[model samples]
Target: MPVPCIILASPRLRKTRWPRLVVVALFFVTNCMWAKGPAPATRIPLDPLGFQPPLAQFMLAGSSMLTVDYVDSDHLLLTYSTKKLLKRLSDCPPADQDRVVDGVLLELPSGKVLARTSWRTHDHGQYLWNLGRGRFMLRIRNTLTTFAPMVNLAKGDAFAQRPFIRTERRIGGVLLSPDADLMILETMDPRPSDQVLGDQPREEDKPVQINFFRLISLNGADIDVHASGALRSRVTGRIPANSAGYIAILDDGRQHWSFDFRSYGGKIKELAAFDSTCRPSPMLVSRSEFIAFGCHLSHTPQILGAFNLRGEEMWEQTMTENYVSPSFSYAPGSGRFAMSRVLTRSSLVDSDSFSPDMFGGQEITVYQTDSGRQLLHVDAAPIARAGQNFSLSPDGLSLAVVRSDALEVYRLPELTKEERKAVQMAEASAPQIDGDPSMVLSSGNGDSTGSPERSDPSTPPAGTREQPAPAAADASSSSASVAGSTPTPPAPVADAGPKAEAQTSSTSASQQAPAEQKPSDIQGDATPDQPRRPPTLYAPGEKHGNDPAHRDDPR
Candidate 1:
């Protein structure tokens, strides 16, 4: 009461009070803004870490294009032709069309050229197969000859070449074992009696001959080839690690034949035969298992089965609707399998060929290798090119899909501790060779171990000398170095929580069943009662249908 009676308010006092109030207000506003932080970035930058750079820019004059492969976490294998002899065959003679070419193994993320070799071939290389442990096989052909040259990837030396069984016949198909130690070649034999009926010759009338060969040694000086007799049906794939031999789908002049392979003792044993009303797709072989997709002639569901080396059906999944040519990747050590199929509104004009623009979109389904349980299912954009268009990384931790303009990278669902341990142990115990490891070409400081100290702008010269290094130890060291040097991934977005939970839920549902459960307990049991979901499809130039759902998905 006494203080109120004074009522003394001077102009200075009033001005000071307003100034203090304004300052307090300004401080509160500043603190609020700071606490909220800058608005999060709308999109993450396309960091080069754990991704392949756009390689089209690297193409040189007269060069076709670069074909890229994720060799491992640390390296990328790139093969490309500097000249196109076949394309200009009419103008340039075969002799004049001598193609100058090589393969480059590059360190990832940094895109540093690690190793380059001119040992590929002067002839056209039709295919490249990665045989684990720094080795690759190139199928090369020219006007006169077709042969497969095995290259010691570490040495960058295509030391051995196994020519086709018959020079006259064209190669129908080539399949390599997981380790690339064995090869299966198929050739088409056109019978004289089967005359050309139309513009396109009758494929069924022409019989296919098969041959199996083993690469005994891959020395630059001496190479040995162990060839087997021709089989009736086409040789589909090799039985992984079964130096005993290769697998073939028999063609006994019938609609269905036994799935068999030549034993190491050179004897054919039947795995399982298809029914008369059913036809099977090409067989996919892993180290210990083989899988094939089969469909009945009637309106029945398609069947996908995984079989052991002993020919026992481990598990099966049924596809209710038809799908266009799908891609599959399997990781044996981790027991993970991924299947990608294209969906369309109407039937595909051609099921054998994948037309990226024709399909609506594609769906990738990840499943347990043994249980056939679906781990994760997501939609993806259409592919960019043909042939091994989809790749699962060696560790089964990432999947690289080649889209039209970019290589889209996706993170696979995480593996359980046991699964990861199993993969690591398998890799650790894998067979490794002793003695001088092949030299590598690096842009870094070099001593004669194939590491080039380059000062020129041109491609580094091929390594000439072989250096003494433990193969396994070198691989381990390089991997560790690259991993440590790789750039850190971008910080996670604030909204990643719910999406991650969804992935976890899906993964958990897949792993709910025991991994070692019998085939009967898991086969066709995971989603037997669920309503059929519309097939995920990808078509070129068209926007993906379910954008919001997959916008936050892992990639």
Candidate 2:
């Protein structure tokens, strides 16, 4: 930031003192503007947060940038909607438009609005979250209501109380645990027909669609389930493909489950048994990495990778477009993680289907969740869907974007003692894969695809910006089925706009047998958390309302 050069010098001969006028004005101001050549790329400095001109024009006219999180890093937790709930949020029904909602807490760099409030919400979108510092948690279905702002903001402290009763199971997700203590509630029953129908069924045959899992253990608003289970899928399966916390990858992605729900007493404990499988057109887990992508047919090729819950890989790649969505935001204790690349723009609607036009706009990259380095690279404009504009600051060093003109905030870049000694000398000359680098796959972009019994493994390497090349459109005219065989129906986007990314919507990344080459009576297994894949807030690929270990709707 240096530009003040004003050196005319004609009257100089009439005045040059012995100083030659401060050494020829410091050599034309160091080659005009403080000569610092070979340093041209720079754009991670934001810091907007203004909001006051009529509350920033009614917060960009309602639904206020749909939740710009972070309850600490100096407060920030906006959510707006009023103007008759933004004109009856699509055909009236919060009891006809006024169901109330408005929150503030702001504060950053003295853009002060410190506290403001209002609430009633029963699913309009983004149910709050951020349980560190001043506290925050709000969910609406499967009820969980917490808010503290240092304790008491018109009262709310019932973080969960639903002793199993939704008819035949109906809550599908409620996950938290990056240290919000622990949770993994799930309840699947209504999501069948991706059809596999083989390998042993017959309990009088067809009623299998169970997936109950419960493992709780929170505190503060108390919640203790400890263990609960039900996975009964006697054939007709389509991916235990991905799960989080007590880990699970089930049959299609081959198998990797790994649970330890607190030293086994109530039960849910199995670990180690990975390294194998490519059937990933979706597998995103968290609570110790797992990012799979593979599935774009023309005989497979998409590939992608990040692995290590023993499913190995570490970093592989390939995705020459097919609706590029790939998202991520995470900021737990700020070791950082951004990763975007949305671009859905697929348009078509019917003739076999294609969808993805959530206004289109992406291409991000924050990284350094370890050696993935690349501290901050930007590009966020297709407002409204795809990580809901942008947010990451639960101590990950600020970054709340809703840019068009205001509500910015970006301060996340640091680690230059020669870039942390070139990332600890490239994490000590790479090549460790699991246990070598792994805090869950980090040798970031030094690229590595060996080990795990090579055999090609679809090699592609080089990451940090997950799989950028985005600029989508041309899914080759939609409709396809062959991965788990029969699951083609993706094409609805006239409105399912907000709340996206912990993805799952494949063209099929087929080809299995990897969790240590499957089958062996495979018996139950799981990791620790699930229920948070909820913030792609619009589009990427998956539709799990989550992945904070909630995988897609952990609630």
Candidate 3:
């Protein structure tokens, strides 16, 4: 059965003379208004699970989460976030886990943190896959380097990094292809010195550059750098510091690009660069065509755009409201792309930049890829928000959105016209074998043997009686019924007339001959009684010895 919807209606307020009475009534109504939707499929944690309730069910610890990928049909990979705690302790607490504070690649099934090689600093994370050899291979990148790591969660197992020749100045985006043969990494202004700074460093001049890309092969560890002509930026030589561009991998394995304007259009030279986190996901369309979308913090207004592979402009899709720290994914079977938009409003007193305000927007918008039209929009205000990233199901039927506290699975409706047609065709062609058939049994008038009439809810109910039909009864009365059915031999002929007596005896003897030749048809070892033949009837004059009924009565 489908889950039932929960709706709570507000109660009416009556005019009262007593202030205490009114207060009490209002309080009662307020508590009742706390009704919520059904519990989510499961409860995976945003951080640790000890003091935290299942993030999917309730909002006690201020969490909102969504589904990512399914472990099977029941379990899921959920991405969630909450208010960061200011307190830290040197010694580990009993409930809280002592996580290794380093850039590491970890798998979900087993909590294994990969070791780093040569103190490689990580600014961005890419794809992760379990090699089925108790190790996980992940793609990590920084402004200057991109590398792959084979991490063994087990203590003794060694984690190794395989470096490829082509390194990006800025490795902003990473996508692992479905086939696991190739990965796409987006590159821009590469800062090789971000990781080289000591405890105290000297100031350096800002660099100006355009954005380009590279596609790396996991099988051969080869890189295909984008053509020189592909280097283009929304801002010519120097894009605003807060501005960002994204890369997407379509289902067909094609790569695409887009620009985000979170940093461009303000009095501030940079869009609060540190707090700004923009991670873009590549949804592969085919081997060649894909869609990539992200938010850009710019000196001007922020916007979302899509770039096709042939270097053609498809469309610039943007939200009406201001949103930053955007994450997106293309769902599997659904054919709809979902975007998680985190809206941050700046304080009136602080015009410096966009920061966390009392009121903001967190929404999941799904769009049709074919025409790029909006399909569904869901927003959870005050309760949930998402930042950084989110994931889609393998089949693309559902989307897992990250909330401030937990994850939420937005089950997209079947929207494709073709899919709807197919569903309709299947349902129309399905056999209705239980429906009425001509000449079949009908349950009425004491003789029909069909289904019962529809129950009348208005009528008083009583026990129902069932009886055999006339046709069935007639079929059971005669042995001729066996003629068309199985054949049973007639009992031995009794006192055959003299003219046919010899022929009849010959026939009986002939039948007995075959029976005698066939070693008792019963399989396995037979019981002693099975070997014996029937007793013979006595002749009228031969019955004299122990016949009590005849001896006592003189007939």
Best by TM-score: 1
The C-alpha TM-scores of every prediction are: 0.48, 0.25, 0.37
Instruction: Give candidate 1 regions above 4 Å deviation.
Output: 1-67, 78-104, 113-126, 142-168, 189-207, 216-224, 232-242, 245-277, 280-284, 296-301, 309-312, 351-357, 373-385, 413-555
lDDT string for model 2 (357-392, tens) is 432455566665434555555555433332545767
Task: Pick the winner on lDDT between candidates 1 and 2.
Answer: 1
All candidates in order of TM-score, best leading: 1, 3, 2
* True-vs-predicted CA distance for residue 276, candidate 1, Å: 10
lDDT of 3 by residue, 417-489 (tens): 8744533443352222222111010111111212134221211123221111011101112000111121221
Model 2 ranges with Cα > 4 A deviation: 1-66, 69-78, 81-123, 126-335, 338-368, 371-390, 393-413, 416-490, 493-543, 546-555
Which prediction has the highest lDDT against the true structure? Answer: 1
- Write candidate 1's Cα lDDT for 2-101 as tens digits: 1011123233435565676676677667566554322211111222323233233111110123344566755556554454243344434233324545
Residue 33 displacement in candidate 1 (angstroms): 27
The alpha-carbon lDDT assigned to residue 183 of candidate 3 equals 31
- lDDT: the better of candidates 1 and 3: 1
